[model samples]
Target: MSLPVLLLVILALAAIAYVTGRGRAFRTASGDIRQLHSLPAYYGWNAALSVLLPALVVLLLWISIQPVVINNSVSALISEESVAESSLDLVLSDVRRVADGLDMAVETGALSAADARSLTSTGTDVRALLGSVGVALGSDVSEETLDAAQRYRGMSSYGAILRSVLVLAVGIGGFVIGFRASHKDFRARNTVERVVLGILIAAASIAILTTLGIALSLIFNTVEFFKVYPAADFFFGLTWSPSFGGGSELGIVPLIWATLYISLIALAVAVPVGLFAAIYLSEYAGSAVRAVAKPLLEVLAGIPTIVYGLFALLTVGPLLVDIFGQGGLLGLGWMKGGTAVMTAGLVMGIMLIPFVSSLSDDIINAVPQAMRDGSLGLGATHSETVKQVILPAALPGIVGAILLAASRAIGETMIVVLGAGAAARLSLNPFEAMTTVTAKIVSQLTGDADFASPEALVAFALGMTLFIITLGLNVFALYIVRKYREQYD
Candidate 1:
């Protein structure tokens, strides 16, 4: 049976268990709910959870293990000599795909089940037959591969059958146990609450474990990268030119410099405009104006960064080049093309404006009105009151908002890729093309570079560096917020 169908069956069984358990609980309490220690719904939940959780666990475990088992068993059948230099993974993937296609053909009545089971049937080109039935194999299947695929199909079918039986049996048994345990003296509410708490803890642990896993993976790969390429050159060397061939310079300084320069320009354009916009909306605008204007401004946030990159590439970059390029007004000859640092920085700044304004508006509004009132009552003008009282009160949060936006700008890939040119260069002129660490990471991992090679592994080091920089920015922002933020009792 399909996974979704099995899940639906499990849910149906759980529903039945819930109804039966609730009914049994009422009978045990002699149809008087007050006689029971907990509500009928609690008893129902206890039974429902008992049936669902174990069955779901079994299903998940089976789904995860079945693929690994099948892959190992089928891969063992394909001899290393037969595979030549091709990846075992790729061969196994082809085997699985062909097997799945054969199964589909059998299901759709294009190929009989008996014919699918026996590949040695007279005059039958299995690959051609499969292709006629819409299963396109990359090449003619060898005899050994065809045999392995057949074994894979048989094992998968048996495994599915066994899995369905085990899941259903566990669900029924759990329902029986839970229903029998449902009585007047049973603490159904406490049991159900504990189950819920366990689920919540599991969810929280998944997030933490996922982050730790990512960090460990990055660290392992970075260590490997340094083993092949000197750490000093990777971190401190000024050039970044990676060739799959040996003796290539693998410095990250140029990428880091461009990343920081673009981020600084973005912050310079974003901070003042977003902060001022927040001040206008929060402290000065009327209710109707605030409602209309705030949402309209925040609409920029919903637009994807790719769209902004297009805006930069198609509209802003060309306009700037026309204004600043040779034979233009002022004729500076500074910008030669549409892709440059200024183009990306300006669009990124525009993209970050909504983030800053939204967060800063909330922070500004969070400042106590009494502080504003007291400052104004002391004969301070509205501007002075906002500048002296409200802004000061919200300064830490505003700083946090700016740093968060900065981190985003630093990590952004699509805008930098499409707006700023991909050449990793360190230059003082904003009109010159540049690239960031994220873009380099993408470029390094792509193409025909071997995974074990320094060229490919450098991507991990670049990723780890970007991760650390963003992490440090976040930590600093939190420290500033905690150290200077005022408490309102």
Candidate 2:
């Protein structure tokens, strides 16, 4: 059976187990649920989980192990000549691809089983045959490769059959054990709760481990990059040119400079406007106006960044060029073209405004009404109370909101790619084209460069740099909030 069909069959078995277990519990209780140790539903669920969980575990283990075993067995058929011509991994991939393609051809009736078994690279154009079934090959099929592919297909077919049998056997055994365990005295609810808790803990551990795995991957690759290219050059050097050939300048200084410059301009636009809107909505605006205005302001947040980037590229960038470019509205000639640092920064700042305003509005509203009333009772004006009492109390949260917006601005990619040009340089002019670390990371990993080369590996170093900068922002924002929170309370 196919994998999905096998899972559906297992689920059907579990459903039968559920009914059998529930009936067994009902019979054991003498048709009185009050006499049972747990609820009737718990007994059914306990049995169903038993049939589902063990079968899934076995199915997963079998699926993961089957390919490795088959690959190893077929690897022996690959000749040393093929390995010398191309890497072993690449040759093995071609073998697997050919095997899969043949399987597809047979299943789709493009090639019959008898014809597929008798086919050879000498007598048949194997690439053309596979291509007829929608599998494209990059090169001509070799004799050893075709043989290895045949072996691979045979082993995989047998392995899949064995897997189905073992998984079904395990599922049946689980059903029997769980059905027998369902008795009037059995603690079915406790058992079900323990299983659920175990699942939740496993899920939590998987998330944390996934994050740790990402950190470790970046660290290992960044270490490899630094070992090849000098760490000093990668960190403090002035340029950011990476060539596929040797003797590339892999400095990060210019990228970091542009990143900070764009982020600063974004924050300058987002912070004041967002904070003021938040103040008005929270403190001064009528309820109807606040309802209409807040959601309208927040609507900007729902628009995807790519859409915003398109606006930057098609609309905002051109507008800026008309205003600031040579022989235009002002005749200043400061801007040369549509793509520039100012264009990206302005668009990014516009995107960040909703993030800042929504967070600040919520934080400002969270300040106690008693605080505002107390200042007013002391003959203070409404504006004076907001400035002296409410603002101080909510300053920490506002700072957090601003820093969160800053983090998003710093990490933005599409707006930078579409609005600012891709020239990685350190310059004082905001109108000049520049690039950020995130954009460079994308450029470096793409194209025909070898994966092991420093040029490609530098993307990891760039990613790690962005990770550190964002992490530092979070830590600093947290510190500021905690420090001032204690003082205010």
Candidate 3:
């Protein structure tokens, strides 16, 4: 059956169920709902769901399997001799293209009368052959053949009308059924609650499924990549280069070192500033001060990373060049490149300050007031109390926040792309040029290199490595935070 017909059937059943349920719930001797087992609405909902859910499931399954089945049948009918010369996969692809072309022609009203007749005759012959084969095999003809046979069984104006009517009937039935069940006796509250819970659970499951899908895709592609490029070269080779041509080497050491160097510089800039900001806000700031400072701090987080990248490129880079470049003050001409690890790190650190401070501030505020009072009561100064009692109590949480920030810095792309040099260098100088893994991945993947090539496949390997590193950091941070939370509790 056509998609419309299937949908119509489902909707009609649901509507019928709903109307029936509501009628059962609401039909009263005195037209009053005070004596019902549940509300009239609940019965209607239950009945509608009963009718709709099963039919919808069946329809979904049918739709999901139909294309594959039909494609296979079409492939079989095209003759094994035609495909034997080429690969089966290539033949299947050609069959699909032919099917798609016919569909497009029909949709656009572009098929000649002669062509349409020929196609119809071919379709009929194929369907009959498939049915005979299925029967001879003593099994149900393949679902594909069966579907195709049914589809080509007729071509009349009423076929479209029938499909439409089926869909309309299903929808109307479901609505009527639901309405009928919406009676005083129906348990509407319970029914609605169940539905809400199901929706929430489905949404949660989707998030988890999406994460798993991404991880699996990365793993699959990386495995394929490793088949072409040795794991040792990818992981530990000192030189970093990925050529798109047949001869390519995909070493990751320089990229890894660059990533580490950038992250370290970012942390070095962020930790001290963010820590100080958190201390001041949590310990010293009054309500009014906090109200102003907190939003301003959050505003920093709200700024787009791209904006930070531009700032790094246009503003910070030139400033650095003037101060430390070939003709700058103190005459340290070694710092020539305006865009370097230091520039990217510094901008990235500024971008991450809010994340670190916001988290640390919350943890600091959660520290027991009693601890501070006790330290002060023991003759410690206010600063001493905070230093000795509060900071220690909040240390784990602060560490967790910092680790999260480190992950952010590592994964950051725009800032490094804009400010960090593209050269994959192993220099120790912060002022020298460098490139990071993310930059290389973006550069390599955006071009027209074949996906099956080792050069292109290397991007997947890099992505997998990035995923593992970030995943580990987040998990460790969570573990430490949980441990610290338990301690405080």
Candidate 4:
């Protein structure tokens, strides 16, 4: 059976188990629910959980393990000489693709089951036949590859049959156990609650575990990079030039400066405008005005950064150059090109405006109305109340909103790539074309360099640095929130 069909059967079995267990509970208690330890629904849920969880777990494990076993077994049959023409992994990938193509041809009725089993690459146009069925093979299939692919399909078919039988048997066993245990005094509710708590804990730990995995990977690669390239030069060198060949500077200082410079410029534009808009929406705007205006302002955040990058590249870049470049509008000749730090910063700031505005608006609204009333009652003007009382109460949350916006600005890639030129340097001039750490990370990894070399490994180091910077920002934001938060209750 197919995986989906098998899954549906398991669910049907669990449902039947639920109904049976509930009926058995009622019969055991002599139709007197008062005599039961728990409710009828609890008994039903306990049986459902007992049968469903084990079956799903087994199904997941079988699906994951079957592929590894089949791949190893099939790959072992592929001759070393056949793989010498190409990489073993690449040849194996082609083998799997050929297997899939044959399956599709059979499913579409293009090939008879008997002919498919007897077919060989020696006489047949395997690639052409596969292309006809819309499963294009990447390379011509050799006899060895064809043999391996057939084995792969056979093993997979056998595994699927075995998986279906085993899953159903385990599910039935669990159902029998649960159904027999549904007695009048069984703590069905407690058992169900414990299982649910375990599921919840697993769900919660997913993010923490994923983050740990990422951190470890980055740390390992960063260590590999530092072993070949001096850590001091990477951290403190003034230049940023990475050559696939030796003698690459691979300095991060200039890139770090550019990142901070652009981020600061972006925040300078975003924080004030977004905060003012938030204050007006929360304090001054009418109900209808607030409702319409807030969503409209937030629509800026929904725009893709690529569109913003295009705007920076085609629209804003030329506009700035027209005004600021060599003797044009204001007779100023400071700017040379359109792509510069200022261009990306302006576009990034516009994109981040809604993030700051929406969050700050929510934070400001969360401040108790009594603070505003008390300030006004003390003969302070509405403006004074907002400036003094409301703003102070909402400072922690507003700081959080601003810091989050900063994070967004710092990590942005597309806008920096298209708007900021690919030059990494330290310059006081905002008009100078420069790149950030994220842009350089992309450039370094995509370059023609060996993955084992320091050049490509440096991407991991850059990633680690960026992580540390963002982590510091978050830690500071948390400290600010905890230290200043008002306990209104």
Candidate 5:
């Protein structure tokens, strides 16, 4: 069976187990639920967990292991002479794609089962056949690749059948065991609670493990990057140029400068506007106005960042060019084109306003109402109270919110890629086009650059640096939040 069908069967088994366990519990208690150790729902949950969890675990392991086993088996069949010109991994990928295409063709009745089994590259035009069935190959399939794909498909089909059987058996066995264990005296509630606790712990551990995995991956590749490029050149040098050819400069200073400069401009634009909007909505606005205006303001957040990038590219960039471009209204001749640091920064700042407003509004509302009441009781005006008592009380959270926005601005890629032209210069003029580290990272790894070259590997180092900067910002935000948060009696 397919994975989705197998999953549906497992869920059906769990549902059946739930009902059976509940009925068995009722019978054990002589139809008096009061006589049971736990509630009927708890008993049902216990059986459901028993039936579904183990089967799902087995299914996961099977899915994980099947690919490795099948790949290794099929790869062994690929002769060394066949892959002497091309990489083995790329060849294996093509084999898998062709195999999947053949399976799809068989399923759709475009090719008979017999034809799929006895197909040959020379006798049948494999590429043209696959393309006819809506599977396009980059190149014609060789005889060795065709044979490997056929073996792979056969082994995969067998594995799927075996996997379905084993998973169903495990589910059935768990149901039987759980149903038998459901008695009037059994601690069904405690067992279910323990399972829930284990699940929560697993979720937390998975999050930590995922972060660790990302960090380790970046660290390993960054170390490899440093092995090829000098650390001082990457960190302290002033220029930013990367070429696949030897003797290219790989300085990161210009990229870092552009990142901070753009982010600074973004914060300057976002902080005042977003914070003021939050203050108006949370404190001063009538309920009706808040209801209408708040959602409309936050509509900006729901718009995708790529949309903002396009706005920067089309609308904002041209408007700014009209104002600041050479021989324009300002007549300064400073701005040359539509793509510049100012264009990206302004658009990015617009994108971040909703984030700051939404978060800061919540943080401001979280300040105790008693603080505002006391200020008012002391004859302070509403504006005065907000400026003095409420603002200080919520300052820590507001700082954290701003820092979060700053992190977002720093990490923005789409807007930078579209609005800020990809010229890595350290010029102070915001009108001039310059790129950030993120834009450079995308550009560096985009083309046919070899991973072994510093041009490609530097992407990892840039990623690591960006990761560190964001991490440091988060840490500092936490420290400020803890240190300055006012406690109430």
Candidate 6:
């Protein structure tokens, strides 16, 4: 009996239990007791959960602890001479690798005749010795020693059977218990509600844990980076020309400038267009127009950022160069570069239009209709009503949305990678080629060198900065939404 077979058997038993429980619950609820405490479906769900939870918990604990327990036993069996000669970590790595190799060879039918003979002889000796050791240790000697000894034989037939039996027994037990508990008197609804709440809490816990893990990893690495490169050079220095060459320098000011410039340009393009579109849609556009246009605009958002990157590279960059080329647009030859801050920014703005408009429209529509009616009743024009009442009411939300969009623009990688030039420079002209922190991080991390290099460490520092900025923006957005909700509700 393999693990997969055991799992399939368990699943089949659980499914059967669920069906039986549902039927029993339904019959009991329909009896002449006036009414059931909860719905028949809820009772069924409660029974199914009871069947599953304990078995799953056992399985999880078994899987997590089994390796450590096995490894510790194997370590104790190794010769003291061998243990004294090598580091614990190295020996453990080797032992694990050997165990893994044996397992793979057995699974693939690749064990040689010599190896098979050696394994058989060693397994017998190990089993005989391990039993005495286990007895001395005051545990179940025969069973545990036999299972461990089987590892050296390149055979796990008995152990596999036992594992399968245990798993199946647990699953079957859970199913039977859950099925028996499903009755008219059971508080099935409350049980189901508790399960749902538990699931939500688990999901939230995982999210927080993941965030903390990332923050810790970044902080540790950034501390190491600052130790190697002084804080002053990293923070205040203007030059950023780090490379594999001997005289490499690394500074963040130029990258920061490029990021700010590109984001500013993106806001310049997205804000006015998105705001006007939201205003028109909410205050003036007919339902028919809204129905056709809303989803179509959202379709733009659905387009992948990589696709936008290609669009920026092939379509937008060339168009910008052509329009502001040397022979055109007041003979501004200096603005002829195909990849520039403006090109990336413009493309990013296009990408964010849906983000801005959709958020703005929802906030605008959330304003009380009575406010609009009152403004109209006072003989205010539609434009005036929107300008004075709706827009003002939704201002905080709109500002929050814009800040979020700014963060997004700052974090954007694809458009900048394709459209913004790779040269890190601090120039006022948006037409000139420039690079951003994200672009530099990508460049540094992708280089063919040791991962322990100072250049590589810089990426973690940059990532930390980016993470903090985005996290701040999100926190601010949540605050705005909460405040607005309180005001209206």
**Candidate 6 per-residue lDDT over residues 1-489, each given as its tens digit:** 756666677667767777888788877767544467887777677777776666667767766766666667655655665556655555555444444444555455665435533564334453333333332222222322333444533333444555666676787777777888888888888988999899899988998999999999999999888877777887777999887653557788899899999999999999999989888888788999999988998888999999998998899888888778788655667676789999999999999998899999998998989999999999999889988988899998898788888888999998999999898998998888899999988998885655666778888888888888789988998788668857788
Listed per candidate, the RMSD to the true structure in angstroms reads: 1.8, 2.5, 9.0, 2.3, 1.4, 8.7
| Candidate 1 off by > 4 Å | 120-123, 482-486
TM-score of each predicted structure versus truth? 0.95, 0.92, 0.73, 0.93, 0.97, 0.78
Leading candidate by TM-score? 5
- Listed per model in order, the count of residue pairs whose N, CA or C atoms clash below 3 Å is 0, 0, 32, 0, 0, 0
Number of the top-ranking candidate, with lDDT as the measure: 5
Candidate 2 lDDT over 368-479, as tens digits, reads 7888989999999999999999998999989988888888988999999998889999999999999999999989988978889999999999999999889788888878
All models: lDDT? 0.90, 0.90, 0.75, 0.90, 0.91, 0.77
Query: What is the lDDT for 321 in model 5?
Result: 86
Regions of model 5 farther than 4 Å from truth:
482-486
Worst lDDT window (10 residues) for model 4?
Answer: 480-489
Name the better of 1 and 6 by TM-score. 1
Candidate 2 local lDDT, residue 27: 97
lDDT of model 2 at residue 146?
88
* Model 1: how far residue 116 lies from native, Å: 1.4
* Ten-residue stretch with the least lDDT total in model 5: 480-489
lDDT for model 2 comes to 0.90
How far off is model 6, as Cα RMSD? 8.7
For candidate 4, list the clashing residue pairs, or say none: none
Q: Considering summed lDDT, which 10 consecutive residues are worst modelled in model 1?
A: 480-489
